[model samples]
Target: MSDAAIHPTAIVGQHARIGKGVKIGPYCIVGDKVILHDNVELVSHVVIDGNTEVGAGSRIFPFASVGLQPQDLKYHGENSRLVIGERCTIREGATLNPGTEGGGMLTKIGNDCLIMASAHVAHDAIIGNNVIMANYVGIAGHCQVGDNVIFGGNCVVHQFTRVGAHAFIGAHSMVDGDVIPYGMAVGNRAVLTGLNLVGLKRRKFDREEIHKLRAAYRMIFASEGTLRERVEDAAELFKGNALVQDVVAFIAAASDRPILLPRNGPTLD
Candidate 1:
């Protein structure tokens, strides 16, 4: 379009589809299979390649690399796609890789996500809306991250893990298991320390609901009983509370990795 602004230093491939009012700044390289939706802004030195589709009003900062080939050793140059939703902010040096042949050939990021600088979203990661990944966070391949999840700086999520909605992961945590909804996970191995009380309160969760969830957390992790025993007790005690029920269901549905157990004191290990 005539009103669309593209700097002379940028390289837009012949088959690339750039929408109305899109702005490409200096030294950006948009590949042939890429599609940039309306009002999207690409800052300097960004490279958007592969079969990537960027939605409207999104912004890519300097040195970000989106939609590259999957890093999986099993990837064999198969056709894949990376879909980024509207109004998303990808900060400088963020790298989002496409899916591998084994991972369904698609990686997705939902609307309004703030992916901070130097964050890495590996092959086939599916991130839901309103997610905030802080600086240098690393999400491994095929991880499913739910809506409104907040990952602190330098957090590392292992492959095939699921982070449920409204979960808050503290900085430098290494998450290897599924994170339950409304939970706060912290420490090196990412233990479910407690309910994300402050975050829930900020999100307008009622005080009564918070109390119920806190009670559920106490039964799940703080109590002296075994995990199976705790779940059985929680089923009887907190059946009326939907949030508590969700936590119980989460524990029941966990397959390989168990939820983190609470320690007696604040030990890093």
Candidate 2:
């Protein structure tokens, strides 16, 4: 309220809820419905519009556009929200959009995410905590990205795709399918290349757990059995191993996108 530091050049709406210690820099525009939590900072030239809530301790760099209207043609001025969680860093020129009524009316980004410069997160996407999107990454609407996922620069994900936890997407990839947890995907129309063994090790995953996951992955992708049959087999074989079972369950679950598989394997779709 009174303690907030609002630059004279900024145009913050009278109805905007500015929390304690918040800072609004020069030439920024905050829409009437925006709720900025404590200690949030918007660098110069940032624009946050629409029905949006930015959590505490977040910093948005100069020229970043947040909480803008969805790009979807079907959106018709419906009441929607864009929620960004705490400790996030939205770099310069990044655009984060609100949701449309067609897709749950919400676009949410979890805590501690790093969205690099020029990255675009479209409407209705739910990004998990600790995620990192490198420069120029574009995530289409309704995509679900799991926690700790990493996207390389210029990677583009198709709408409604699901990328599981700890997955790695290589630069310049065009991903149109589901990537399982701990998987590594690369190339145009990305395919499952292998497990993210490097990520697993970096995150301190146990060596034996990694071994079991690798074995389950091979069995699931083996050429001898149908995809469904292989999934079931892996489910039964790795029943007690959560790491392996996570992958098996992701495959078993119903999704709008097909599961990404190795290029050498059957698509099974």
Q: Write the per-residue lDDT of candidate 1 for residues 1-269, one digit (tens) a residue.
A: 56679999999999999899999999999999999999999989999999999999999999999998888999999998999999999999999999887888889999999999999999999999999999999999999888999999999999989888899999999998888888878888878776677788889988897787777677766447677897789878988988788777766876565555655522221
Q: Locate the minimum summed-lDDT window of 10 residues in model 2.
A: 260-269
Q: Each model's TM-score?
A: 0.91, 0.97
Error of 2 at 102 (Å): 0.5
CA lDDT for candidate 1? 0.88
Measured by C-alpha RMSD in angstroms, how accurate is candidate 1?
2.7
**CA lDDT for candidate 2:** 0.94
Off by over 4 Å in 1: 222-226, 232-236, 265-269
Candidate 2 clashes: the total is: 0
